[model samples]
Target chain A: MVDPEIRVVTIDDLGILRSVQEDPATGRVVVTITPTYTGCPAMDVIRADIRRALVATGHPDAEVRTVHKPAWSTDWISDAGRAKLAAAGIAPPAPARRDGVVPLTLAVRCPRCGSPETEQISRFGSTACKALWRCRSCAEPFDHVKAL
Target chain B: MNGPFTFALALGDDSLIAAQRLAEWTTRAPEMEEDVALANIALDQLGAARLLLTYAGELEGAGRDEDALAYLRDDREFRNCLLVELPNGDFAVTMAKLLVLAAYQVPLYTALAVCPDERLAAIGAKARKESAYHLDHAMLWVKRLGDGTEESHRRMQAGVDQIWPYVDELFTTWPDAPVDPAVLRPGFDDTVTEVLTTATLTVPQVSWTPAGGRDGVHTEHLSYLLAEMQVLHRAHPGARW
Candidate 1:
């Protein structure tokens, strides 16, 4: 059974990992990661974490490469990933407009009180991928996941 | 653009000029929210430009890193397209240029993200998000300027007119340029049309076109910018923060 308590945040939950592939012939795995923003400080931590996980998982030969191109988006988060985030008490991103025709807008939900009544405190939140929002009902400050 | 030196210079020079222009708004935009917003954009461009110039230098197999390419090149040697190097005439003009550039970039990077080349796809993916945000911000401003007031409309129109010529040069990929137009669809005409329509402005078609960035030619403004951007680094040579 899937553990109910364990949380798997969206890749947006942490940040972008472009790809994770293992080469059986070489017995080497490569995990490609990129930052949400150009110089997000979390990137180093993520790289280290991936390395630790690989080593701990008996894949000591694994390599983590950070690639910055065609950059990252919040949209890459998988359906299963979003479910994990919601169950973890963190809200998930809304559906992306795949058509690229309609303009993007977000109706941020309050994570604290589960209310829709909220206000944007700033366009930039603690990080590039989030916005600072405050709950009107609970009067608590929170970070809203920006729609990429 | 003149020759090899000029082309190399242009690659770095365009980013330098464009970066400087964008940086001018640091803490000087109409509001605090926008101040941070504009600064973020400037920083993103600066970082990308640095990488591109550094890569260009490496491709040349010269010892020069990003700083050398950015700081050492002379004005006439710079080859950035005119649109980027032009004066940031006003907020309206800045917004207009941002709209055109970012709109072009979105699709450009979208195609680039999937390039068979790993590095290109990586860079394209990284740049794509920033380009999307830049385009979104520009669209918001364009709508505001276009539909706001008589003065805003006048300025917006003027801005569009001033920058129209520069648009043509962005697509003129020189024969020897590393980036191939064939790999990516040249969708400038369609993309620009949609944005202009959304902004409620008429797209202008003109025969007077500018070129030479791919060939390494640039205007007089480039030299001064290089002097300022490169001086401290050139003087110190490998100084680190």
Candidate 2:
């Protein structure tokens, strides 16, 4: 039995690879992915990568489809994902409000220096999903996953 | 309350209206990647509309949520530009339109991120990133198509030919419009021209441009799209998915 937690953490930490499904007919798998943001350049490569991984694991004919509905959110990261994120040296997304209103003090910490003393340089980073951050502790720049 | 909600409607209308047009190419794009790309862009636009409209409904406090406003409104009520509502003629044509509009919107959101209204600013913050990717995606295609084979170049030119007339409507300001175009990003035309030059495509020369979407006067295509989009919501009011 595959541990659901590991899958959760892997997806959460990587911030890609949205959902996986196994086909009962041929025992093949289909993975449903949503890009981190709408215009992610790596999405096509990621889709192909997912297909390759599934095929390498004996699901050669497995089909993968990308879905955009209900949209992916940073809030979907599970506890296991948070742990993986911490271990990966990246800070996890701050908790979300049930009321759907973002709190004012929800500043992201720099992963490299582990300092909350950072500022948002831009809403965009190296990739579409991350925001650029400059750490006060190390004064090094890094990307922080923006809250959805 | 009125200004914020109206501004939100302008944003929402832009996305919802654009998505409707992009959805027309769902199964008809040149290739699979193109299909997915178009659909993904459409979905992103739709999602943007949903977010903005939901916020607008909350601010209005009139018991009209996103669903009610999106589904129940007539064409005249929408505040989108005519450029978004124009039909997708061919791949190059669609890409040309995308290049123009996305070029306009990327800077528009970049500046809007600093808006005094926190919600608008926050939404703009998120949208700025999304629209950048969108603009890049479309711009990449514009370059590929423009510099490709002779047949490809012809189609690309033809695409521009068909879409050139509609471009002027995007920057026009209407006195009674929901969002003032003057308050939008300046030099929109210049930015579009720069993008065209970068793509190795010449900007089409046109004298007359169509404009009328803000007041709900849309081409006949819009009614058909609305009919298809709102059927489920209209038939079963208050339906949730």
Candidate 3:
């Protein structure tokens, strides 16, 4: 049987795995997920993917549930996901600041050239979860997953 | 309606109306990037509207879902402020309206995040983050247009003036609400002032204030906006794409 984490990560790019447990009697796996953002359209896709992956991997009766408690933060993205995002030329979000002060400027390092000198082109990027940025060093435009 | 139900409907209507106005800019924005940006913002608002309306339906103990509340209700049944229902006059005007509305939403959601209602608090926590981005986007535009060329600056100022009269309506509140809108005014003012100052613009001094959207009294623009938004859904009646 494939590991549940690998199966779930195949679909959840945000790395929002909260919990996975098997029912002792039914032997059915129940996966719990927390969304990256409340209005993220990717959520439906993620849910469908999880169900498909689990069902295809011999767990035909697996259940996926979404929870809202302890609201999702960018800090939840796994280290592996962060590396994957950078390898894909997308800057992973910085750790969320506990202090409520929102920084006027986010110093996102360019994933293309690993340069700290990056400027934000648009707050709303190609997707709701990212911000468009330009690397001053590489002169290439990229997306930075926003720190929500 | 109960307190939570009414409050949820008001929030849902605000997002729904704002989303409709933003959708009007899909292919009409001055820049292609703005076309995508406005559409994204509109989708965000639509998503929020769906959540709030769905909750409202559950609170009301009615069989009605988000669609019934959104498409079946008459203009008079909506509880959104008049500011959201106003026409998208131009890019400058749209930015001006967005500046005020987004600024208002930031503090409003922040306060609601800790409200007594657990479900509302959860929604508020997520919404607070989204609204911050919306406010930031509006601030950047307001600064660019307000401090740009002479014509752009003048138009930006005029946009502010046109929308200023309706700003007061956003601060109106009722008892037992999750957050007192009046308490959010100071934060809203400070944020707006900082942005306006950076943009080299002044707050407009308006003498007349419009109010009463919470009581179903809205500007004439809302009826037209609703007619256009609801026509398809009303015609089909439970048709799903």
Best by lDDT: 3
**Model 2 Cα lDDT, one tens digit per residue, B90-189:** 7787888898778777766666666676666666665665676577667677778877888887888788778888766766663443335655535667
What's the true lDDT of residue B153 in model 3? 95
Name the runs in model 3 displaced over 4 angstroms.
A1-13, A23-29, A57-62, A99-101
**Candidate 3, B74-182: lDDT as tens digits:** 9889999999999999899999999998898878777888898887888777777777778878998999999999999999999999999999989986777888788
How much lDDT does candidate 2 score? 0.69
How badly does each model clash, as a count of residue pairs?
19, 1, 0
Q: Pick the DockQ winner.
A: 3
Per-residue lDDT tens digits for candidate 1, residues B52-145, read 6766676667687776767677765566777887777889899988887776667766665675656546655666667777877887888888
Local distance difference test values of all predictions, in order: 0.66, 0.69, 0.83
Off by over 4 Å in 2: A1-6, A10-148, B174-180, B183-187
Assess the local accuracy of residue B123 in candidate 3 as a C-alpha lDDT between 0 and 100: 78
In model 2, what is the error at residue A43, expressed in angstroms?
19
Task: Summing lDDT over every window of 10 consecutive residues in candidate 1 chain B, give the lowest-scoring window.
Answer: B1-10
